[model samples]
Target chain A: MLVTVVGNYPKIPNLPRPARLRNAFARLDRGQITPEELAKVEDEVTIEVLKEQADAGVELLTDGQVRWFDEQTYIAGKLGGVEINGLIRFFDTNTYYREPIINGPVAWREPILIRDYAFARDNASRPVKPVLTGPYTLARLCRNDHYSSFEDVAFGLAEALNAEAKALAAEDPPLIQFNEPAITRHPEDARLAESIWRRLLSGLSGETAVSFYFGPPGDAVAAALNAGFTTVGVDTTIPGVLDAIAAGPKPPKLAAGIMDSRTTRLEDVDVLAGHVEAAAALAGSDNLYVNPNIGLEFLPREQAQAKLVRLVEGVNKARGGAK
Target chain B: MSKGLLTTSVGSFGKPPYLAKARSDHAAGRISAEDLDKLTRQATQEIIDLQVELGLDILVHGEMERGDMVAYFAEHFPGMSIGGLVRSYGNRYYHKPVIHNELRWDGPYTVDMWKYAQSLTDRPVKGMLTGPYTMVDWAFEEYYPSRRDAVLAMARVVREETLALQDAGARYIQIDEPAASVRFDDIDLAAEAMGIVTEGVTAKTITHICYGDFAPVYDQLIRIPVDQFDLEMANSGYDLLDVMREKGFDKEVGLGVLDVHTHKVETVEEVVAGIKRALEFMPPERIYVDPDCGLKTRTWEESADKIRVMVEAVRRVKAEYAIE
Candidate 1:
């Protein structure tokens, strides 16, 4: 249970393009590249990104999310009745596409494409964690365009996403991590969120470990435990988060988020190591994982590489101490 | 009516038990929109009284009815759809609105609220609006083919609202564009977009920029047509005052002498030193003291202490200069 660095990288572009052209491509409703062409571009980008992550000596590596624009949009594409819509402005010049508005009778669109992405990442290395956006977060953030209520939409999304998770599990990856940053937004939706998580995990087959990231663990922790998942991820850098996770069921693996990804300031290895140590103390050293809280998409390439290097070195040092 | 010290609007407020109950009742179908509006009015009155108790020069309606600064505008405006999830600092999440159609403001976005607060007090009330650049920067622009077009459309809607506020007897209007610094790479484009959005608003206008480096955008900010510029300085330790002095910015400068994002109340001496340092760059008359941004992120107690320290610091600076 020694703390291991989980795989997830932010979007890093190799060359600079005109910002206008980039924005145009991002928001283009029709014309230009087809979905297959976009997938081809993403596959090429993922290959190069996998090499970068592998070179950095990260044990688990993501395809740098080249396949999807953001974490949720990728998951939304597979869910039935979710139509990807226009681009919205996100914090200061950043923008992401709206996840498809879930219309009536949400169901899987026949054999969700988890195997396609898992096979893509598998080309890079072994034990790749196929990432999925959690059902609760997708439902909470998305407009209930045609759904009668949030709970109804959430349950449908859960069923759709769980089908994808089971499909990915068939590929036999080491784990499947769901990015559920939206869970922290609606504390009132905790019960429904927990139910969604429980249903998804209960339906998943095989030894696929499920993890969450970006916000507080919320009632999803209990849901994950009740569903008998192995690891629960928590952003430890946020105040009062670790305490909340500690209050949950015992002996669950903790993906302790120790690195800051939003700002330009690089984490001092010793300081980050101290956070890992603290997390280990709280949740047994055997049950801890060192990770950056969220994606590194906001960071420059040089900074992202530097942060990853420092993280790997810090984790190795902390693990040695644990041994 | 006595003139008061300058103040700017910040989002978020402690929803008291009564307000919470009112909101719950409204949600549970026990109250109508009119009833909720009345409750919100009562809360605004109470907030204005608190501002008077603190002896501040300016006042705001505390944005009691709004869930967030930008979301309030989106709910009222047409052609805006919310998309994507944004994490606000810790675990707080905001669903950013996407502009899907041609943008237009129907009329008088916040005039009723602004007028209501102003009517209650002789003291000047600052009208608050989120700037065009910030609205464009903070939301997901799914409908617009380009970011520049999206921003221009957003500015048009904001300009309409700004003019309406001026017509409604707003003396000072604060357009918060905290995202300005984040778009520093495209300052000229931001300036152009902001220029269009702020057109024809003759009232005294102030633009606030915070949460990032200021040196790069300092010159660009000065070029904007606003009367005053509000910036976050205390957090940056007045690191860019030299740049301001070198540029010789003549307009009124709102020096953020208090940190608003944290709970730690800055000492009076710290606030005074920050102001004194800024005074060396600009005249005391041209300088206004305020917190870095809105005190909404902070607890009410911390916000109060920070404001108290800020006023005391201003008084100390004024006494030293022997001005009032």
Candidate 2:
């Protein structure tokens, strides 16, 4: 059985200088500080966050997504014709920054500006998994102002992302996973989803995997398989997700998310092992990959790190590795 | 705004004869959306008639058209996709939707429907809206360069809808933002984002904040520009109100004295005591009797009984306060 700690890097502590600056920026939003000083604080925090993730045990570390407010909008800024909008109260909780629809011809403005951060992560002990939000999810989430359908904007975004993925793949990372949690929503609209994935994977140069979470697998799995992806990820917690594996032709390794990421209830290692065992039985141990069900963005720093430690340990034990 | 009577919601109070018929018709494909709307209208009218008979002040349309208050909005908005399939705390499974673009109202969203309901009765009709923050937070959000920007756009869309309701002569607008308590860690951001949505509304704005620990957000809650605060007090055992009293809350309080989740119909005396207990913290005039949240989850009988008791309780309290 193959076990891996898949998903975004765990949040890291702030560097003394940049920590002060990020705090200052937080204060600016609170009206405790002025907007004029925000730029200086952002730069400082970005540098410190990048450096901290590089030092952490994250195998596929990112810039901790510190520069952008959220995942989709950050990628939208890289592609042409995409404009981001203000924060909105999301859920009964806090605010989320969202991307407005693209209203013009979409194109890549420049190579994604992750070089400084990528260089930092590359120097770390573990190989990084260059992360990109899947084109389908992005298309489905943002307004398609300029394009006729979500697919049109998605295809354009996939091309832009593929260009960046190709450049990042040249950096010799072990894998690149495209995050597409939104694919699980449209089980009925599988053909449209498959086409988008086909185009997105076509843009990448090397061995790449596409991962999804928050829900069960969909027709996108078959699309990823058809696109010759090396791995296809799915959240195993949802109903019928395991059946999705049975439905598709087994071509790539399956990144089976067995750990619960949304709730604070800690999973017993034995229970986790049972889930992994079931996934391995279905996909075969050689094809199964272990991970949490979704991203840990909502979890507090301590809780997320603790959950990861438990997850990594449980997966290793399930794979019959001596912990 | 009177103190003599209590209020109850329609459709949710008791097991209406139409519920079984509607469910059967829906399963058999014999009932269309228009049919369902008609059934809801009739059910709402019956509830209004019951409230009038009970002599309650405020009347609700029983949230007839809505499935889930926040989730329903996702179905209408463009550039939004439901992400994951998960069961809510109430055992109701909802596909979590994600906002994918700049949100804009296509036409009059809820106004026409509410206006139609309002036209049916001479009683003051309360127009309910899910707060912009709750709509954004409950759904999967598209990533943005600026979180604040995305929130502002959502708020603008909400503001447009709210203003339209006011223009349609809605005297009372209830913006349900139950998710506000959960986002305590990001209270300031939430306040800023919601501030944009609530700008320039002349109607009696009453915000319903429920479900989570309100202690963390109480101070911030007071700062929100609204006329009244409808809170989940009965379900939470009134600890939140005590916290608010300690924080020196002086605004109008929508005291949710009835528990709409359970089938147990509270007595008029119990309802009176619940209100009287609340009066220890604030004056009776500053209080409005209501259920903690919507009674959509409860059966029609339970909803009616709960409201009946609430109204009786208000009468008892009013009589006692008058005697004093």
Candidate 3:
């Protein structure tokens, strides 16, 4: 079994590192530095994040999404016909996101994450997976002034994001994961989300996964698996999620989101190993990938690093050997 | 003076430059605790003086000692530990706290500040607290068996603090549940927690919620066991007024007429228009005018300018309507 993270990692360093990225941003706002200067700081921070993940034995890493203001706006702000607005709480967490106000037809203006993804891929010591916010979530999270209905926004975003996905596929990474936590919260949108996922995954050559957290994906589990996704991720901390996965037309791969990422109380290694063993039983060890229940952004940078170390230890324990 | 169109802030004024610097020095052990307290009182005095000068009806102590609302309480409370930095939004971060053991309230957290602020003015000062649901929602809870247990326990702690404030002669207590609207599914849980927090308190209670799409929880919000709902209306174009009008809000409303997030202060006319729109639906006697949220994020100059505009707006609306 391989250990991985869902998406974001903390951008802030542990301590005494001077918070170069945060300070650089403040300076950029003050007109003390240019956009190019800010991007250089972002690059340096991304390298630090990649180094941390590599040191923790994470086989797959992300750029820590250091460049993103928030998950929703980072992509939406770059796309055509969307404007970033004031902060709203991201899901139930304390963290907030700048909302995307859809003012006109949603269209792919350019490749949003390609540069950051390329930066991570170039600097990372391990495999870097490209992550995108799924169309359904982007649609659901946005203030839809243009679309007739929520589903319509989802459809519009689906077409728009498909173009970006195709552009990313040209980079030829092993897999691309679309985060659609909204489908879990509003299971009523599962039907629309299924169609959107199909549209998004239509012609991508690389492997694809859909990661859902904050709760059980409900009908979305079946919807994602049936959409021909190579992998389906579930946050096992959410009640009924493990049972739902057990009662499955299981996908080819399972990213078992077994560790709670939001809380700082480190899990007992034995307990974590037991969770990995249980998940392996559901979807054979070869098909299993261990992960935190969601992105590690909610935890402190130190805690996030510690959690990743624990996750690797658990995976190793379950596998009965050191990698 | 009229009971209608009461002017107030939604708690918190931006710290002065000297005080902000003092806080940093104190944190790094370059200054003494007494030194920090003196500067905090000085900053509080400045804010109270400004509010009085602006002819505002209610005042806040400006939260000079607090680095973050929830974390401040976490530091005071037992069985919790101040954890590490986590991003709250764009270019902003706060030390996210962790509940490592059972929650306990050792003593009054805000009574001294409330007392000090109230002593400086004849006008009422709000006894501010981070609400129970918000405390649980904002922190990483490691102790309690479930979220409900954690929130209910926190409510008891906050209830003690509210009672302490009342005992110390606070007329109004604002328990800010900014996270309540964020978790719309748990509005009932938040309401139940609020009930526990305010059960024995005699002071008028207010809960401030912001940055949420409140259409789904508007009904539950009205019933959240508080005397008033201090909402962020100006930032959301006052869409909440439509919901309140349709739902028929019976309680007092702290109508937010100025956007606090932006540096640009609203024109007096802009705020007057917002208050007038609320007046068409709800009576002025039941309305309290304020900024959309705390002005902690703004510069001291910006906060004062915005409050000045808000005060002038309320005064003009009152004069025109003969509200007194």
Report lDDT (CA) for all predictions.
0.69, 0.67, 0.88
Model 3: lDDT of residue A89: 77
Indicate whether candidate 1 or candidate 2 has the larger lDDT.
Answer: 1
Highest lDDT, which number?
3
Q: What lDDT is reached at residue A42 by model 2?
A: 52
TM-score of 1: 0.54
lDDT by residue for model 1 (A1-323), tens: 33233444544333342222233345444566665665565566667667766676666666666545555566787666877764433334343445467766777776655655665656786345677667777776677778778888888888887877877777777777776666665566667676777777776655444555545667766766676667777677777877777777763677777876654456677877778888888878766667777776555455567777787777777777877
DockQ of 3: 0.68
How much DockQ does model 1 earn? 0.05
What does candidate 3's lDDT look like per residue over A1-323, in tens digits? 77888999898865766778889999999999999999898899999999999999888888888888889998989888899888777887877898899999999988888888998999999999999899989998899998788878888898999999899988888799999898888998777778888888888767898999888888898898777688999998676787877886777899999899988878888888888888888888888888999989889899899999998888788788423
- Chain A TM-score vs. truth, each candidate: 0.84, 0.82, 0.97
Q: Is candidate 1 or candidate 3 better by TM-score?
A: 3
Which digits, one per residue and each the tens of the lDDT, describe model 1 over residues B187-260? Answer: 77767877886777678888887765678677786777788888878877888788887877888888887766
Segments in model 2 whose C-alpha atoms lie over 4 Å from true places: A1-290, A293-323, B1-30, B81-84, B89-92
- lDDT of predicted model 1: 0.69
Leading candidate by TM-score: 3
